[model samples]
Target: MREIKVQLYRGEDDNYVELWKTVEKIEGKHRYYGRYTYGNEGTWYSVCDPLGYCELNAPMADDVMFICCDENGNEAIRYSNADGNKLPKFETVIKREWNKAKEKLQHNTEDLTKNFWAECWNGDTTMKINQWLLSYKDPDLYPEKANDYDENWTGCWAEKEIGYEPIPDTEFEYLGHKYQFTKVKHKHEYCGIEWYEFVCTDSPYVMRDTPWVNDRAWIQSYMYLGNWFDDKTYGTMYDQRSAREKVVAALIKKFPMKNKWDKLLYVKKKTGNEFYNCDCCYEKSYSDMADVLINRNYHRKDVDYLCKFINKETEGIVFASNRGNKYTIRQTYPDIYDYDNCLI
Candidate 1:
């Protein structure tokens, strides 16, 4: 069996530390495996065969210990301040940072929720004012009549004075386009009678006014006039404006333009991997799976879905696996069984 050993050495400048690895052969000769140079700036450059070299920035205490694993990735040894003193493990540093980030994210989410409701609904904000301006209730089709009416309620139940002239089976210019308005008869269940309503057949957009309550009501009225207004419907103005604001807020949260957590959250969501500290390994695994899917002629969307599924389903297994073990779909998922079978 192969054996590996790790050693820490002070750099030539004495300002940094070099972490070196050596693999022992059957003949007892040691070969260089990799090295990482850690400096005071909280960044390190890792150089290994095949994978080449890369820089990693991790927030770690200066006195933290570097835990070295065996060839099988078992914690076999640890290096502290060179005096055999107790120190925090490498994972401890990563876990602390992750926890801090999670707390910040939770606080930001709460703030965002509160701001959305306050600025969009409760306050006299632009969105709230716009909603108020757009709010409308359809003219009461059936007004209640009072037995004895006062001067204040004289016209409360009077028939509507304003009438809409029918411009039927003709084309009219609206928003720089000619649209045909057709006169259609609709039947109401309550009245058991038919009424004539005019509708624009080919228009730029659905008209919200006239015989319909809202855009949805106007669109559905073609099938049946009973759909002109639903009893459960919120006022058209409030519903439409509220819906727009909600969509805007959702989009902002999903893809934050300026926040630092935006990129982190996006990567986590896309890869479906929670171990952000292992992004390099996660990316390599994701690429390998993508290549396999591409070779099978799977669509891009399908490949993305399969990668997400594999990452999610194998998350626990990957976490429990040996640190150095390559977390591949074949090794983690049940469908692939083995490296030779690429069923997924």
Candidate 2:
């Protein structure tokens, strides 16, 4: 079991910030069921049966903190203590936190136009290669291995593909920086020939931040820490417009009309639904057109991440229909059992 987490603030009554916040729709008359704690009450030691009855006879749940409403519903929980420590409505906290997540999700997409190249392999991403060479050789792991062919110590050491022949190591002075070159190959053949290819070592930021993609690259790969020995996902990074963006971009392209009247409202999905809306929810009415972002394409494993699909634009362009971000809304909700393209 994971350790129970508690958050203590100096001024306010201590709150169980780690508690799982849930939502309960209130009907005519409702019963309450769950475990809870009062002011300075350490944790959820008090249990209440259904029908809003706090018998206070149940034992303390030392392991976890929860407030679950049963199938019958009516699990309204209002916890307080002698010292006046009180928790707001269960879903209230849930909404507050959810809003922060929603805001981050909606705005997380960066301008994919920048070419993240390494002027020098000195930063966190690039120095790693320097460190690797330092371990094997005293001063520098020159492209000596890069110039020759040997499985043990070479730039593309781990790639044992039969056909690939290591080209001689070449370097030149460019703006007072040395850029090393190893065997470069096309990721995949295009139109029966290799057309577009970019170079970055096993890991991004090794020599330069590699091009997994900048809106055009597919789900390409890089080694873990630029080291071939480490286990890694095939694609370290990738890029393409989102399913919704693809839809909108395509609509603007296909049905091109000059004026406002000709502008087709192709999108059917707009934000503002209960599963994501916590405020309009529980309340009598909901916010009109709640523009909360539903997902942030992030690589959950490392900080450099994307929660979006690994499919290239050509592959995911089908979503360029009425998907309108709403498609991701359905697939990327936090609690979904099987989230499509969920990097988990």
Candidate 3:
């Protein structure tokens, strides 16, 4: 989670200043709303729920609080404690803290973009990755633009395949500083690519600060395999089916295969130059090639990690072997290996 420090303009409520000035309180709603208002204004101030505007059944607004001020000392709003011990509102501390948050978010976004691009080429799109991207683009960075984007975005349009709403802004008290946080959400296009939106809030931060992203770990696990072992080219005009074939062909092309039988050896080959065969040869079943990938010590290390198709039907890993046949449960099961291991 990222953090940002804000100053309290005179006339801003003590509650508002206190709320927008902490580290912990700023991380929770980091990916949601950028707007934060106290419960003193009634539940009507809450964009947290879908109940519209109305007085909430919460407590008084004197617990912990803070005020927001522009660089010119224009007080925008006040944040206050509804039920917790009041926290202190420090101008310098808030500013310093928030600066760190912004840096982390920016770093995280850069890392996420690289991973996202790689996964797109692999025919897999994890929602967690998309959600992380939304957080990295935290709405606070582009409040006006994010709000405008949300106004037109239709989140979760196709079941859960689409995007989610902004995280919603919130405030909380910690170590005498009340922290304010904004949540962010995003929308996805028909191409399955995601774009961001914001839902500003006035709540406390919750998530802790951490390294933006683990680029080394990501590169070691994903980049290494894609670049070296899998023999899979990226950004090509192919979906899952076509992608599998291309990978298999890539494997064949690496060998000295000459005939159908030799190609079968290439298909079933585990490793070494012996596995190399002429490229002109073909195999009767694509499964023959899959068997090679499945058996190899190198590919096996992370093959299942890359192949997300494991299920009761296609068995083993979801990778497309040979020509894409031999889909069954038995072959791919956790504790079995043989021709009958797969159902198909």
Model 2: residue 331 alpha-carbon error in angstroms: 33
- TM-score ranking from best to worst? 3, 2, 1
TM-score of each candidate? 0.15, 0.17, 0.21
Q: Please write out the lDDT profile of model 1 over residues 1-344, one tens digit for every residue.
A: 22234433222223233344443343685333222333223232334441233222342343544455444444555544333433232323333333443332211112334435755653322322123222331123222422222111211121121223233334433212344433444433222232343333443324334344222233211211011222243332232334334333433443243542321111112254544423222222322322322343222343444444544533433321222333343344333222222122
1 versus 2: better lDDT goes to? 1
Task: Estimate, for each residue in 141-221, the C-alpha lDDT of model 2 and write its tens digit.
Answer: 233432232113222322222122222332322112233222333322111112111222222113233355332322222
lDDT (C-alpha, whole model) for all candidates: 0.32, 0.27, 0.32
- Candidate 1 achieves a global lDDT of 0.32
In angstroms, give how far residue 221 of model 2 lies from its true place: 17
Which portions of model 2 show Cα errors greater than 4 Å? 1-166, 169-180, 184-246, 253-344
Provide the global lDDT of candidate 2 against the true structure: 0.27
lDDT tens readout by residue for model 3, 1-344: 22233342121233331122222245463211122234322211222331222222333334334344444444544454443323223333344444544443421222445546645664323333332223222234434434333212223331112222222233333333344534333233322333332222224323322255331111001010000011222212222223344445544544434554543322122234434432112233443564444442212223433244323312323333333333333233323323332323
Once fitted onto the true fold, the runs of candidate 1 whose alpha carbons sit more than 4 angstroms away are 1-180, 185-255, 259-344
Model 2 TM-score is 0.17
Model 1 weakest lDDT span, ten residues long: 220-229
Cα lDDT, model 1, residue 297: 24
